[model samples]
Target: MHQLDPQMPPVLVFHGDADKLVSPRQALALRDRLLASGNRCELHLVPGGGHNFGQDVPAWQEKSRALLRDFLARQGLLP
Candidate 1:
């Protein structure tokens, strides 16, 4: 658990507001846990998006990709 180790690396989470398989609240809960442990966490809630953006919405898909890329760059995960 993050609370047992505050030195863990930060995390970036993405959840769709319209997801039916998994609730967005789960993402928020994990983010809260990470933050409570003094670790950095980012959660991006995609509006009108479903799981994996499988709703066939191009705009939401692009937005999700952009957010992911930005997060990776900010965390030095992308070159």
Candidate 2:
């Protein structure tokens, strides 16, 4: 985070609140650092979700797709 660039492209992050592999606090810190660096960042924390949360769940998969679509649209990366 110390080497983050303010002019870098926006970022979309998804982290599981119950993730054991990586802490959710790390994602929060990343979001904060990105925003502090004048970069755009969207953070989504899935409740009761593990490291690979939403990978096997149909509902979560759809939700993730929708979020990605919206994020790309907002960045003008999608039509």
Candidate 3:
């Protein structure tokens, strides 16, 4: 579907190394498809992380928030 159109809304994806529900490698595949069609996208691979980082530790949560804030700010998604 998206392959037929190059212009599309971008999505930011974060994958954990220990995610069991979804393969982290799938993120890369999605990224490749978006890239092939000249669509905007972002991907972040977190190490020592799992499917639920928010339930892991306070530090990880803070770090995740910080990264998200930075990305949004850079993309002008947040004012």
Candidate 4:
């Protein structure tokens, strides 16, 4: 977290709120740290979602794709 550069590219993060493998608080902390360093970040917490929550769910998969597409478009990586 301390090694981040303010000039680094924007970041988009997605974490499952109910994740067991990794605490959701970690994502919040990361978002805070990135913002504190003057970097752009977007964090999304999936409700009732656990680790790899989108893998087996069709709806989640589409949602994830939409989120990624939107993020990329915002970053000018997609049109």
Each candidate's TM vs. the true structure?
Answer: 0.76, 0.92, 0.75, 0.92
Residues 1-79 of candidate 4: C-alpha lDDT, one tens digit per residue: 7689899899999888889999999999999999999999999988878888786344777898899999999999999
Q: List pairs with backbone clashes in candidate 4.
A: none
Evaluated at residue 58, the lDDT of candidate 4 is: 47
Which has the better TM-score: candidate 3, or candidate 4? 4
Model 3 ranges with Cα > 4 A deviation: 1-4
List the candidate numbers ranked by TM-score, top first: 2, 4, 1, 3
Cα lDDT listed for each candidate:
0.79, 0.89, 0.74, 0.89
lDDT of 1 by residue, 1-79 (tens): 4343688887878788788899988888888888888889998888777787646456766777788788889989997
What is the full ranking by lDDT, best candidate first? 2, 4, 1, 3
- Which scores greater on TM-score, model 1 or model 2? 2
Best by TM-score: 2
Q: What's the CA error at residue 76 for candidate 1, in Å?
A: 2.7
**Candidate 4 — which residues are off by over 4 angstroms?**
none
